[model samples]
Each structure stands twice: as C-alpha cells, then as structure tokens.
Target: MHMTAQDSRGSRASTIFIVDDDSGTQQLLADTLSYKGYATRCLSSGRLALTAAAEDPPDLILLDVMMPDMDGFEVCRLLKMDQATRFIPVVMVTSFNEKAMRLKGIAAGADDFISKPIDATEILLRTRNLLLVKQYNDFLKEHAGILEQQVRLRTEELEKVIAELRTTHQQLVQQEKMATIGQLTAGIAHEINNPIGFIASNVTSLGKYCERFLTFIKAQQTTLAACLPDPDQAERLQAMGNQLKLERIIDDVPNIIRETMEGVDRLKSIVMDLKCFSRVNDAEQSIADINQCLESTLNIAGNELKYKTIVKREYGELPPFSCHPQQLNQVFMNLLVNAAHAIDTKGEITVRSWSSNGWIHVSISDTGCGISEQHLSRIFEPFFTTKEPGRGTGLGLSISNEIVRNHGGRIEVESLVGQGSTFTVSIPMKSQGHG
Candidate 1:
C-alpha cells in the first residue's frame, strides 16, 4: 500500500480498475488514483475484475500478482483474450523481483509490472503514459473512420461528374456530325437541283417537239397521197414510208418521251426530299407537319431500308405543330435506320403518326428481332450499344432522346425478346422555345 506521488495533473477524470485480494491494498490504490483525478473501481478478486471490465471496460487495470482463485498473470491473459478489453493496459503488482516473474507477466500480456512496496512515482508515471497512448490511438481510429467516409463520398461524386461529362461529350460530337452532314447534303441538293430543273424543262419541251414533228410528217404524207394520183408515185412513197417504219416511230416516240419525263420527275422528287431532310435552316422553328418529316426521312433512308425491310405508313390526320423540323427529321431517321437493322433478314417497318389529346405521336415499329429486358433500360444511355464493332456508335438514340426532350417530347419503347420493338415519340403540339 505505497502512496507517495502527487499526480494531480489532468482535468479529465479517467476510470481505472484496481484488482487486489487485500482490502488495504485496494483502498490505498483507489485513494491514490482518485486523488489524481482518476475515477477508480476496486475489485477484490480476479473474477470480479473480469466481470466488471466486460460490463464496463475501464481505461486501465491495476492487477495484483498473488490472488486466491486466479493470479494477475491468468487475469491479464483473460483480459487480453477478450476483444473488448484487450486494448486496456494491465499493470501487474507483485513483490517478486525475479526476472522469470517479469517474463511470465510479459508473456501474459501485461503492459508493465510493479514490484511490492510499489513506488507511487512509478505507478503514476506508468499509468499516465499508458492512458495517453490509448487516448492517442482512439483519436487516430476516429480520424481514420472520418477520412474513409470522406473518400467514399468524394469518389462517388467524381464518378457521377465523369458520367455526366461523357454524355455531354457524346452529344456534342453527334451534334457536330449531324451539322456537317446537313450542310453537305444541302449544298449537294442545291447543286443538283439546278441541273435537274433544266433537264426536266428540256425533256418536257422535247416531248412537245416530237409530237409536232410526228403530226407534221403524217399531214405531209396524206397530202402527197391525195395530190399525186399516179399509182407508181404513190406506191413509191408508201414503199419509202414502210421501209422507214414510220408507224412504229409515231407510236413509240410518245411512249419513250413520257417514260423519260417520268424518270426526270422522279429525280426531282428525290432531290426535293434530300433538301427537305437536310435543310440549311436547321435551327429555325416552324409550324411543321410531322408526317411530312417522316416521309422525307423515309425517302432519304430508303437505300438503307429497302434492302432489308418494307416500310408501311399508317398516317392519321395530325395538326401542324411548332417544332424544329431538321431535328425531328434526325430523330425519325435514327429510328428508321435502327428499325431496319433490327431485322435479320426481311421484315416490315410500320411508321404511324396521329394526334390525340393535344399531343402528336409518331411510332416506328419493327417486325425484326426485339430488345431484351436487360438491355432495354440502357438503350438510351450514351455509348451503350449491342451492335457489332464499327457498325454503330450507340449515340443515335441517346441524342435523339435529348432532341425530343428539348422539344417537350418523350420517347417510349415496348419490346419482346423474340418478337419486335416499337418506339413511340410523343411531342406537344404547342411546344415552346425549341431550336
């Protein structure tokens, strides 16, 4: 029961457990530690100390070496084995000065050993130093937990930002590509329109000239037959006419001119469709017919669709809606092309449009292989594609979705794995501020 040093240093009142069989020794240690601003609990047996420590672990344990039921070494070993109490420092109190005794205490996981007739200075110093180390360790663990949480949060935020940036980049690239294509097509349409116009006009004139010449030749032959009554002269004129196949020329010339004129008219229609599909005023807003946009897109994408699928139009009466024509054309184009590609061999792509409840709906349905449930949700996600490499960039639907959204519209899709897919685009009739 040695109590000599004054450890009245810290403001914090830390709890310490003092275990000893001797009542005098327990009271002496508790009083000394309590005076030093440590809340002390006195347990008279090793079993009582372990039970108390498990219920409410103290910062440190002062275990006596020589006890009845269990000694300090066994008590220390038990405390160290418990997960909750293992980190608590154990200072063994004994009168033994043998080196083997210290080694046994150390093997039992004791932090330090105090000899009998303990110096108060030594006990206080060792206790204060162990408590400080424990406090520092706890602080570090708390700081590490906070740091890990912060890192997790920051990583999530960065991932979200990176995803957004990738989407934006894909959109920008698509927009630039569409813009260049529009400009090039518009220029080509302008260049070709001039020649087509003149060719069409010239063919029309040529047809009329052929009709006049045929009429004049027939009238001259009839006049010659009536005026020259000699059989030899009339027979010679008939022989010349039969040799030249005059009747065949008169019948075939009109048919040939008509077919040529029809071909020229077809060329003009294609050029007009090209111009409409790639209009130079892409950013301009107008009250446009959605059906007309679909028709123009169909004509422009005919070569892509013709080889694989047949297009069926089921257009209902739709009111003119205010929107960007070129953008809508692009949306229809993407849907049509995708529909064509969905077909493995031959299939039908049905395009339907109708207006109801103040909304204009255009649906492109394919009889081709449909999307799977697993992939349907991610079809509009940027860079998500099921097409083979180099066959697609996977941004078509995503960009089209954005374009439709800007025009106060949405796209809905329905599909079965083996059946087919239908994509419906709905736009408000009174959409505002879309370019």
Candidate 2:
C-alpha cells in the first residue's frame, strides 16, 4: 500500500485527509494523526478524496497508491493541478520498493511518501514540517495585502493635498488679476466722474435757460398780437406761428433737457457704484449702510443678472454697521452672480435685509437650480465646484465665507434640488474687528 498527504494549516488543529481503499490503512492513519492533536477525514476512494478536499479543503491530504478506482499518483497530480488545492503539501504512501514508483510519485508533485507497514512517527514528522511551510506562506500573503491597502490610502491623501495646492495657486493668480482690474476701474471712474459733473451742471443750466426763453417767446407773441390790432395782420402772424410749429417746440425743449439731465444722473450713479465696488482700500474699516452696499453690488452686477433674472430688494431700516464696505460688496456680488448662474432661464433673485437681536441678516434667495444635499456641505470648500472647466475656480463661496467670518459673521444656506436656494448672511451689529 502507498499513500500521500498535503498540508496548509494555521493555528487551528491541522486537518488531515486520509484516502485509501483499505479500511485498516485508513483507520490507522486517522488514529495516528488524531492522536497528535490533528483533525482527520477518512475516505474510501480517490474520487471521494478529491471531492471532499475541494468542497472543504483540509490542512493536509493523505493519498493511497494502488487503489481499485484511482492510484495515489493520479490523485496527487489532480490535487496539485487545482489552484485552490495546489498549495497543500502532498505526501505519498506506498508498500512498493521499486525506484520507478518513487520517481512516479515525485513526478506527480508528491512532497513526501510513506511506505506501508507505515510508521506513525514518520508520518507525523513529515506532516508537521509541511504545515509549518504553509503557515509561513499565508503570513506573507496577508502582509502583502495590508501593505497594498496602506499604499492606496496614502495615495489618496497625497492627491487631496495636491488639489488644495492647485486651488491656492489659482486663487493667488485671480487676486492679482482683480487688483489690476480694480486700479484700472478706479482710474476710469474718476475720469468719467469729472465729465459727468460738467454735463450734469450744464444740463441743469440749459433747462433753466430754455424755460426763460420759452416764457419770453410767449410774451412776445402776446405783444405782437396786441400791437397788430388789425385782423389780417393777426391772422398772418398766427399762420407764421403754425408754419414754424413754435408751440410744440416750446413744449418739447424743457422735456428734452429734463430727460437729458435724468440720464446724466443715472450715469453718475453707475460711476459712483463702480467706484465704491472697486475700492482698493480693502483693509480699512468704516461706518457703512449694509443696504447701500447691496444696492451698489446689484448695480455693478446688473448686466450679469439682468438677462436671466429679476432682482427684488426688500431692505429694512438698520443702524450704521462697522465693516469693510468693499469686501462686503464683493461677497454680495459673488452670491448674486452665483444665484443668476444657477437659474437656467428666467427666474427671480430676492435680496432681503433686516436687523434683529443685535444681528443684521441679509438673505439672497433665488428661484434657480438648487444644490444637492451631498454637495451642499462642500460648497464652501475651496476648489469644489459644479461648474464646467474654465467657467469657475470654485473659490467664490470660500472667500465669501472667510470674509464674513473675519467680520464676526456667518453664512447659512438652505436648498432644494429642483426648487431653489437661499443663502443668508448674519453679522453682529458691532463687529469684533471694529474699534
């Protein structure tokens, strides 16, 4: 009789599979292994051993040679061929003394062999050695898996840091660009303001002068009518007046001058808002009406919002607040423009401001596409944006939040995916940064 065994056991009692056609041999092997504190499964045929080993792999396999169905060599070869069972160390048992049979067992992937009239001590020693090697292989595999997971986690963290660096660099570039634009805008506004003043004054004077001229023309017409006295001369004078359309001209001149002056006033307001919105002295704190700041931001951002949205202002009276007006204006502009972009087509952006409980609240609500719950929390995180590339740098909300916090304020947002969104900014009436 001949047999083989394989092993892959850890800390648990090593399970050994005993496969042989002889009942005595099977019983002998099971008893020997069991006595050594190892678990043993006995099977009568090679097919039974293969099926049992595959279904529930043992730590070791004991295979028999010279069976009625299949021999130990064939069984060992089959076990070694399977990826799941291949690692199990196979020990072949045989009664034959032929060198050819030992070579055949070796060729079949047998790790060791036991000859019949099997020595229990020899079998135990061989089984112990094979199991030790299997345990070491398992340890190596587990270690490699842990190292792979660690590398994956570290890679993700590195990527996150790189993204933040890119965002900071982009923000610096944008700030520099804005600084240059602010300087240019301030210069242009100053130059335009002087000409606007001249035009406005001239228009006012021109309106007054035209009114006096019209009064004189009316008096002259009356004097001419009284002096002519003759009906034919009076009729001829009336015909000349009709031909000249003098009455219509007298009525239209004052209205034209009035409209011109109104245009001049509107232009002046725009320039003033532009100047206030682009003020370069951002670090200086001053007394400012928050409502006026919102109005100025709205005017400066009018073109961006007007095409797709209707802006509604609901401002309540509040005391003078201490803050950087220009920075607040910047925050409002960012929020307003973002609201407009959220809207797909026509929508309404409501700017509401009020004061209560020593805090001033300004809420900008939009009837536009609102943020999802998943993305809402990260909206103020730098470099997080839903906008397409080149359309956004994702720093608007981040910068706005920072500015508000510096003024002892906070920004809160509420949104519904399809309906709309409301962003409310609350500031302490007396800011900590102010003197």
- lDDT for 248 in candidate 2 is 89
RMSD, every candidate, angstroms = 9.1, 8.6
Mind giving the per-residue lDDT tens digits that candidate 1 earns over 270-296? 565556545523467878988899999
How do the predictions measure up, each by TM-score? 0.55, 0.61
TM-score (C-alpha, index-matched) for candidate 1: 0.55
Query: Stretches of candidate 1 above 4 Å error?
Result: 1-12, 19-27, 42-56, 65-86, 117-121, 148-166, 192-277, 280-368, 371-435
Instruction: Give the per-residue lDDT digits (tens) of candidate 2, residues 265-363.
Output: 777866754565355245688899999999999999999998999999999987897888878888898899899999999999999999999999999
Worst 10-residue stretch by lDDT in candidate 2?
1-10
For model 2, what is the alpha-carbon lDDT of residue 118?
90
Badly placed stretches (over 4 Å) of model 2 are 1-14, 19-23, 31-58, 63-129, 229-245, 280-363, 368-418, 424-435
lDDT (Cα, 0-100) at 300 in candidate 2: 95
Task: Please state the error at residue 137 of candidate 1 in Å.
Answer: 2.7
